[model samples]
Target: MRTLKFLLQKEFRQIFRDPSILRIIFVMPAIQLIILPLAADYEVKNIKLAVVDNNHSDYSRQLVSKITSSGYFQLQHFGSSYKEALQEVEQDKADLILEIPSQFSKDIVKENEASLLLSVNAINGVKANLGAAYLRSIIQDFNRELRLRWIQFPRFNPEMNIETPSSNWYNVHLNYKFFMVPGILVVLVTMVGAFLTSLNIVKEKEIGTIEQINVTPIHKYHFILGKLIPFWVLGLVVLGIGLGIARVVYGIVPVGSYLTIFCFAAVYLLAVLGLGLLISTYTASQQQAMLLSFFMMMIFILLGGLYTSIDSMPPWAQAITKVNPVAYFIEVMRMVVLKGSGLADIKYHLLTVLGFAVVLNSWAVLSYRKRA
Candidate 1:
């Protein structure tokens, strides 16, 4: 107990002695939690739109006004030709192109139908699809309004009775920031535990202190614990700050138990710290540890449903994410925080993260050598 206390004191002192490290430990997490959530929003807004109106009619002008008035679109340019509209989109100045045919008004009057050409950039497939869907719905509503005014002898008014009732669960407003903030917090915490601890251990090796520690009476488990506990606490502190910001600044509050979320976070931190220890065991230099940790972090974040849904991924890719502790942690965090899920709802994620913690810690302890 005395030895453990001494080691813990020493570890804390070392961490605080370095101002840069302390700043990184405390400041970086908060910055990332605040900034990344704002940047990673998936909600499509202020989408630049270009219109090529060849009809020059009142109907075409009304359509343009409707498209612009919809909050989803911002009219940037009026192109005279399809080529110019396409150029505006291709040059990244516009996200969508609305082309009204030359005989749009005549076609609608004679044939009772007119086609409007809508070209959307498909690079971000989901956003593009959503934008296109919004545009189509607006057009459909306009056409329905036209039919109601033009065709007065309507029997039963079939179109008016046909309604598509839509309700979004968990997130009624569909705020992408609310969906992403919790997940981003998980990623940021994971990064700190995985990257910082690994580098700290490797730094000891580079500075020739690892050999000195190996010769001491300090137990290996105690040494590793002393090194890791501070980081685990720091990660949790970061999680708390992030949650506060999410609630206060973003107006996102978890409907579930905060204790339950913290408990899972504790388990997740163990897995992340274990991974860091494993990396430190293999790396002789801080640079190597940092690089390896960064590469692994990228892979885990990408596979962990940070930017995309895992359900939408391929079967093989989803299977691969099962081994990733980040994936389980993020899944459980979002479920509990956003969905108001209970313990029963996240049993698999909890168990999976617990298993990872045990396996990774065992591996890290076993792989660490007394002498390099």
Candidate 2:
């Protein structure tokens, strides 16, 4: 116990004395959490639209006005021919094209039915889908208004229409940052924790201190715990800074218990720190440890479902995520922070992360040789 305490004291003093380490632990994460969510947001908006009004009728103009004023679309072009409007989409100036055929108003007034052609630039598939869907919704709303005014005798019997009201749980306003911040924050924590710990023993080896430590009376577990505890605490501190940034800059506060977040963070750091320590045991220098850790972190975060949905991934990729610690932490962070999930809600993840922590630290400890 006494030896471990002294080792921890030594590690912390070395950590605080190094300005570069301080920057990775504090400055980098603070700035990134503040900035990443802003740029990585997934909520698509400002879809450019080209309207081709062959009839130039009042109803066609009204439909265009409804679409443009709905805030989802911007009027990029209003051309006389479908060819010109299609050109706008081909040039990438427009994401969607709305073409009203000849006698559009005449058809609606005389036969109570009209048709319009809609074309989308499927280059950016998600943007195209969402933009087309938004335009369709606005056109549907306008058609309902037109029905209310033109034919008062009930077009389809309103009493029989099925209206589904959807509630966006966790993110009521659909704020992209609210969805992204927690996941990005997890990456920040994982990178800082893993990179630093992985480099710790390697740095010692680089500076010719590993020889001295190995010849001493310290146990391998003591050395491992000494290296692990400092960065583990620093990881939590970084999380604290990140949470503050999430609140002050982005107006995001966790709906779940802070205790829950902290507890999961503590255990997650164990896995990350252990992975780093294991890498350190194999590498001979800081540069090698850093490069290897970077490569591993990239793979982990990419598969961690931060930018994409894991369910949408290939079945093989989805299976891989089952063993990915980063994926579990990302899930737990979203579950607890956004959904206000209790321990019961994340028991599977909690147990999974616990398994990771146990296996990784034990592996790290065993991988370290007392006499090498």
Candidate 3:
């Protein structure tokens, strides 16, 4: 116990003394938490639309007005020729081109139908797909409006309409920040825990301090605990700072208890720090530790459902997330923050991360070599 206390003092002193480490501990989370959620938005908007109107009729103009007014599109180029609109797409001025053929209004009024062509810039696939889909929906709505205006209901044949209204649960405004901030908080905490701990022991090795520690009668687990505890505490500190920022800046307060968040975070840090310690045991230098940590963290964060849906992934990718500790915590954060989940709801997540902490810390302790 005495040995572990002394070691904790040394680690804390070393961490505070380094300006770079101080920036990582305090500045990184503040900057990233403030900037990332605002930038990393999944909702696509402001798509540049080019229109080629041949008929110059009221119906065609109304259709164009309907699309632009929907707020998803910007009318970048409005020309009479498809070739000119195509030029806008080639010159990168437009994302999509809507060509209304000649006699469009005539066909719609006389034949009750009209044809239109959509040319999309497929280079940006997601934006192109969503933009085209948005335009199509607006056009369909215009068609329905036209029918409702021209045809008198209950006069000749009554038209049946089925309205399906949707309620957005948890996120009533469907704020992307609400969905992204908690997950980003998880990522920031994971990076701090894993990166710092992985580099801690390796820095000791490079600086010849491990030799001095090995000559002492300290147990391997004691040394590991000393390395783990300070950073584990810092990891929670980062979580607190992040949560406070979420509340003040973004107006996000967890629907669940703060105690629940801390409880999961405590165990989650053990697993993350244990992984870091395991990496440190295998690595001999700070550079090696950092590169390895980055490599593993990239895979973990990408597969952890931060930006994409895990359910949409392939069967094998889904299998990989089951073993990923990051995935578990991100899911738990969303469950607790957005869904108001309690400890009982997160028991499976807690137990899984607890298992990860046990396996990883045991491996780290066993792998650390003490040489006199």
Candidate 4:
């Protein structure tokens, strides 16, 4: 225990003595947490819409008003002809074009049906699909409202219907920032912890400092713990800074207990920092450590369920996330923040990370060379 104590002191001193390491530990994650969440948002808004209103009747104008007032759409161009409206989409000014035929209003009133041409620019498929769907929903609502108003008059048959009102739970307004910020915080903290720890040992070797340590009576696991403990604490500190930014700047407060988050984070740091140490044990230089770290970081982020749903992935990719430490933490962050899930709720994930910590740190300790 005394040996471990002196070793930790040396590691912390080395970390604080270097200005570059200090910035990488404290400033880098804080800055990235502030910026990345805003950029990583997925909610598509401000869909540019073009309208070609050949009917020019009260019903047609009312339909246009319904669309623009829904807050999902912005009327970029209003044209008298479909060709002009199509030009708006062709020029990339509009994502969708709604064309009303010459007798559209007349047909809707007299025949209860009208033809509507929707031209969508499929360049950005997600935007095009979602924008078109929103427009169609707005038009359908307008049609229902028209039917309700028409029924108010002396119509022979009247039908009453039951409507199911739905509410959006967790995120009441479907705020994408609410979902993204926590996951970004996880990634930022993980990257800082893993990358710096990976580079630290490799740098020591490059400068011939590691040889001095290897010649000592200090046990191998003692050296590994000395390296792991400081960065594990810093990882938690980064998590704290991220949560503060999430609260003060983004207005995100985790509904779950802070204890649960910290508990998961403490175990999570072990797994992440252990993985870094494992890499450091195998590599001879900082360049090789960096290359390997980058490769692993890419795999962790891509499969981490940050932007994509794991359920939607193939069975093979889904199986890979079982071993991806980043995926587990990101999933836990969202669950605790969005669902108010407690430690009991994430027990399976906790155990998985614990297993990772034991395996990785043990591997790192065994892999380290004690002799020249």
lDDT of 3 by residue, 1-372 (tens): 888889999989999999999899989988999999999998989999999999999999899989989999999999898888998999999999999999899999999889999999999999998989998899999998898777775663326666799999999999999999999999999999999999999999999989999989999999999999999999999999999999999999899999999999999999999999999999989999999999999999999999999999999999999989999999999998999999999999999999999999999999999963
**Model 2 deviation from the true structure expressed as Cα RMSD, one decimal place:** 2.3
Best by TM-score: 3
- Please list the C-alpha lDDT of all candidates, in the order they appear: 0.86, 0.89, 0.94, 0.89
**lDDT (C-alpha) at residue 275 in model 4:** 95
Clashing pairs in 3: none
lDDT of 1 by residue, 1-372 (tens): 788888888888998899998778778888877788778867778888889999999999988888789899999889679898888878898888889999999998888899988999998788789889989999998898778766654453545656789999888888888778888888888988898889877888888888998999877788888888888888888888878888888888898989889888998899899899889988989889989999999999999998888999999989989899998888888788878888888888888888888888888778878865
Ranking by TM-score: 3, 4, 1, 2
- Please tell me which model should have the higher TM-score, number 2 or number 3: 3
How much is the lDDT of residue 33 in candidate 4?
A: 80
> lDDT per residue, candidate 4, 219-324, as tens digits?
9989999999999998999899889888999899888988999999999999999999999988889899989999999899999999999999999999999999
- CA-RMSD of model 3: 1.4
* Highest lDDT scorer: 3
Counting only residues 3 or more apart in sequence or on different chains, how many pairs clash (N, Cα, C under 3 Å) in candidate 2?
Answer: 0
Q: What TM-score would every model get versus the actual structure?
A: 0.93, 0.92, 0.97, 0.94
On the 0 to 100 scale, the lDDT of residue 80 in model 3 is 93
Residues 1-372, model 2: lDDT tens digits? 999999999999999999988987899899888777878957678999898889988898888888888888889999788888888878889899898998899999999899989998998999988888888888889998887677644555544546799999788988888889999999999999999999999988888888999999999999999999999998999999898889899898899999899988898899889999999999988889989999999989999999999999999999989888999999898998888998888888878888888998899889998787
